[model samples]
Target: MRNNRPMSFPRQQARTRRFTIGVPRAFQISPDGRRVAFLRGRDGEDAAACLWIRDVDSGAEHVVADPRTVGAGEEDLPAEERARRERLRETGAGIVSYTVDDAFARAVFTLSGRLYAVDLDGGAAPWEVPAAVAPVVDPAISPRGTAAAYVSGGALHVVGLDGGGDRVLAEPEGPGTSWGLAEFIAAEEMSRFRGLWWAPDGSAVLAARVDDAPVARWTIADPASPEAAAQTVAYPAAGTPNAEVRLAVLDLDGDGVAEPRWIDWDREALPYLARAGWTGPAAGGPAGGAGSGARQDVVFTAQSRDQRTLRLFRADPRTCEVREVLAETDGTWVEIMPGVPAFTASGDLVWIGRGGDREGARRVLLVGGREAGPPEGAYLRGVADVDGERVLYSASPAGCPGDVELWLFDAHRGTSTPVRVPPPSPGGDAADGTGEDAGGVLSGRMRGGTLIVQRRDMDTDGVRTVVLRAADGGEPDGGTAAAAGGIESLAQVPDLPRPRVRFWSAGERGIPAALVLPSWYDADSGVRLPVLMDPYGGPHAQRVMRSRSAYLTSQWFADQGFAVLIADGRGTPGISVEWEQAVRGDLAEPVLEDQVAALHDAGKRFGFLDPDRVAVRGWSFGGYLAALAVLRRPEVFHAAVAGAPVTDWHLYDTHYTERYLGTPQQHADDYTRSSALESWGTVNRPLMLIHGLADDNVVFAHTQRLSSALLAAGRSHTVLPLSGITHMASEETTAENLLLLQVEFLHRSLGGAAGVQEAPKGAGGV
Candidate 1:
């Protein structure tokens, strides 16, 4: 029953949010293993997400809560909620995220600033917690399931499930202070989304208090609407002071009253709050058993401003005493992997440690006075879940740099082995040449003996999720359950044409890359094609992966009569640690050199790329690389479309920029060399600068300054300013038309139907 219809790729891509609208995400498996809760939009074109639950036994699905039922429209988001979503890069609406109690009996979420709680076992409709304030954000039910806590109007509040005894737990003391919320840097750069964690006993909560008074303010205005007042934002640029963040434990009694006890830590030495959470009593301890009154352990991860040192601290919530458990140091910056510094039920501290006989490989280390890691060559990615004595994690297997697989490490058994998660069925409608079976990416959660695994590969169109009994054959007890069942995804099928991708490594550095050819391309014709080098060649972000959907845009560009090349040179993740850290202290040289090397090697092997007519296009970090290509190496790249590019490293944020280039005062030469602004005077190729005027992240000043410098140098360039777009082009029309405009520009500049034009002789003419 496939509905094949005619549709514009650009319009469909924009309307579907890059085909992510209907995907089921944020999966949570109940400890009892009875139900799995997730969020999904109504369909591919629907932007409003609804909460859904699947029965593990019968595989029956039910819609627990829908925004439409509550009469809340998608456009009524609070200012704080909007800002949070922006930082998360989330484009969906309606129950975008929700939190469940430890027992998974109840769930809490916010829609249009109204907090709603649902009883999972009772199957009752969600009821609003009558808040004195209208808008609330980040609501979470207490572990005890009797109360819910949320942030509203710069204050943290707790209310009972019966909608009674509503009281404020903490409030801001100054104009720029807020309780129970993550600051801009923490949310945007550090990847620590939540600002509060509830103790396992539900007797208390640990919350973050952020004070932004010391940060500098920047005004963002809409020039098209001159009469409107400009929006002011507290921005911490590189080398600027970040918001002061302090953690406090809030003791919540049965009556919904709370007393705050501030945790003592050296903010001057470790200013970056990487993570915080509570762990139960150590294994075999007096209070380790259920119903024990022994205080739960509070753990946190902190990093120095330079990011070279990261420390794990254990704090006493009662007396606020902090003690260091472990510390890791690196010559370059240390990466903060997600789901680490976690404690096993047996009291062992689980973490990712670097260099254990593998030279530069990151390995999962279990330490409880003693340290142990997985077999050599297993590059640990992140910790997924820690049940009793087993830790489920994702890692790149030995000799498979492009594949990520799930492995279970049992500290009690002292064995680490791959989990037998099912892979996608072979012989489907995979992207042209990529249908060959490669390892699928594994991600999921484990509770008790039940595991919820989501599998995706380059050959699959969408993700497949399954609930299964553990490998040890332990079945969860509770709820009309029989055996494990697969969760059916209601996501709409993308009707676009399938992409034809070829994955390979190029150059001596083994730079990973993917090449896409047009659907109508005929290799027998022996016609050389124009080359479009599309890359996000920077740290943390990878352009080349085993996922097929990751190349949809590149495939579309290829269909427009050009060969598309996406290279993941040094500085990208999912590779060895050495490759990721190769760009330290010098961002431009190695990255640009790797891109050029990939292009030449790819062209030499394929013999279909016309190097003389090459153009590059990218956004953000990729945009910076695109501009750098033409400005510094004009002879290699003839044209480029740079979108929201960071021309100067100084204009970027503190954590991300400083991690690579260090402080501007100390590494001034590195900043100058890494900045695209420094080489703008040498621009000798056709370049178009695209930027959103309202973007506060990279700011329009980057484009403005670059254009000014280009003009002063008597160089010709095109600048396109988007009036109201941010770092992301969320506007449907803008996102859709941008693709078409880029296609048209590339066609004209690279000798397509629009006719080719050569630059002036001194401008590095092709």
Candidate 2:
């Protein structure tokens, strides 16, 4: 019986969107580093975020705009906006994103598809631009703060802030074409969400025109509401054709009728436009400070359809001529690093590459075509931000996969130093890459000379955001500290018991693993607990992080009378590139091997773990792994719960699926060897499949096909279909019941007693 519990941890977690609503995020710092702009909700439970600015020295914050006060009272999101938010995993309601002008005079954002601009100086209320089309998207304020450019009805338009001079700069010429909008592949896989970028001087805009005529369309229909029309989406599945993307320059000073000068490139060889922007002397400088229109150069990166070759090019916007700046090719497909193709103040190219060759050369920071820093063995994640001559990056120190730390590279000083987090006690060094604070995660942004460091550690509950100045620490010139001043968070404190987690490296490979036992579990009780292996054993993500928040859900599961084990295995990131690439051409074996290896090693290490009653549960790639665990290695995992899993990789998208398996047309064996559908007939365990009927990312068909295959084999299983829900089960009722139902199923399948615990005292209900 799935009876609801008042003030339950699951309900509160869902209501507060995992306690992320009131956290200060989407930050932008002014040139002087004295003021910072951010987005946050008014209170812990407030869903709509309000725009705020913090006075660095005074430590005072004031709301610049509240969506409830300024908006149309309801959000009528466009399909494009909804899809963009889905891809971004943005759960907040109001002012999700905003762009500031070069001078930091005003900021532009879109609400309910209408455009709104507010002065950052706090003297005026935000006013909606009446000239814009009803449904505008991704409005960017010009560098000179004169006008804003936005996309509407598949066309690019510019509206003057002063004169209200609205004009259509570029329009779609065909049915499947759109201007200033990212293609599905770019947004879902490449992380390049926006298709238009402003030139440094704001006189011109570089926009992408996408034509999806060649792509195949898939239907997403509401089975429950058959009267609803089926929505068709362009899905470039593995081996299918992708949308054609091209770049063009649109001058804001023109009459809005002339044809845009298209950037020249060999599209046949490199069909994927990875990134695009303008680089100039005015980059990150004052409004229209130095670089002008004609002299500015547009830069972009492109990749081959197979994704093995990546090229960066510099283009002359005037002549539409392009020159290749650099090229990197790999036999196993190149990984796309974030915040790249950037530049230093001295006109040096700041890029992340394999240093030299794909073999042996580690992923390192490259400055002006040279291997810059991070020593040799550290795993360089990406260039966080480049301020003048200083480059901030995130990385996992050598031999420490669970710890993610930040390091700064000073081009002027030829030195690379770790950005330290202050010790918990006084008179100690900042959080360590491997020292006492070895289990922390750090992500921050740097602008001008100011740095914003957001940290989540095992010692803390949620995130702690600190603002540091040039003199306090993180000043590009010199000085570094744990933190200077902190931005307060209104996020709700978790109502669950503190997780009793122990971290360690498992096996000879030293896979990062964590064990979360119930707070009530006693070693001397003589009651051996069943083991639950939880893992996201895939690429580009890690499970065994040092953050306390990362394992809250896992801890909740552990409290249900089981020892939850989490692992970051071979295919997961934050480890070595070789470890991540181990699954190439065979995504099933290496990952599963690591998971099983970690489980057995953990079972042997922990005396009270009952290995015979082991179970596995996961979602997305983790879901795939959980089901794979039972189907392929039933002796190790007796029961499984897979939610929204990719049962057959052949149904997955191009950019992500093709990276490891290539085209299914070329490597059919890899798909068969990797997908859970290949081993469906071998199932001999209690298996449950859960999926959302309306999920676009991992569509419902994935579960349907696997269920059909299992039925064909006469294997018994359970399928729970969530109607009218997407990939994210954020609804309070659904999310809470999902937990309750999963725990009930595990107890019944494993023949264990129900172990639901009440909320801790003083923790109010949702």
TM-scores for candidates 1 onward, in order:
0.92, 0.94
Q: lDDT tens digits, residues 567-684, model 1?
A: 9888888777888888988889899999999999988988867889899999998999999999999989999999999998888888998899999999999999898878543548
What does the lDDT read for residue 188 in candidate 1?
A: 90
Q: After superposition, how far is residue 3 of candidate 1 from its true place, in Å?
A: 5.1
The candidate maximizing lDDT is 2
Global lDDT for candidate 2? 0.81
What ranges in model 2 sit over 4 Å off?
1-6, 281-294, 356-359, 423-439, 472-479, 680-683, 753-766
Which digits, one per residue and each the tens of the lDDT, describe model 2 over residues 165-203?
A: 788999999799999988999998998888888888777
lDDT of 1: 0.77
How many Å off is the CA of 401 in candidate 2? 1.6
Counted clashes in each candidate structure: 0, 3
- Candidate 2 lDDT at 97 equals 94
**lDDT (C-alpha) at residue 4 in model 1:** 31
